[model samples]
Target: MTDAQLGLLVATPIIIVFAVALRRMGAVRTTGAVVAVAASVAIAAVLFFTQ
Candidate 1:
């Protein structure tokens, strides 16, 4: 994988965890958090392969 793709692989989970923590802290709504996480994964998957 390219550097950017590797970076994304590393970053995506960190970001997802961070966002989940935020949601648990009541800083984000459940619906929004779920959608964001799903979209993040989908986007990362698409970019990781297509690029």
Candidate 2:
């Protein structure tokens, strides 16, 4: 797959895992999930587009 697609694939699962971990660690469930996903997507976007 292309870099962008690969970046997204890698990022999404990572984000989900982090979100779940954050929830389990007693963070606010919704906030944790949002932050994890947003952070992952932002990083992925940078990596995907910059290369």
lDDT of 2 by residue, 1-51 (tens): 687778677767877787888888887677768877788878777777776
TM-score of each candidate structure, all chains considered together: 0.89, 0.55
Top model number, lDDT: 1
Against the true structure, what is every candidate's RMSD? Answer: 0.9, 3.2
Q: Across residues 1-51, which tens digit of lDDT does each residue of candidate 1 receive?
A: 799899889989987998899899999999988988999999999999998
Residues forming the 10-long window of minimal summed lDDT in candidate 1: 31-40
The candidate maximizing TM-score is: 1
| Model 2 poorest ten-residue lDDT run | 42-51
Candidate 1 Cα misplacement greater than 4 A, ranges: none
The CA lDDT at 1 in model 2 is 61
Q: Quote the positional error of residue 17 for candidate 1 in Å.
A: 0.7
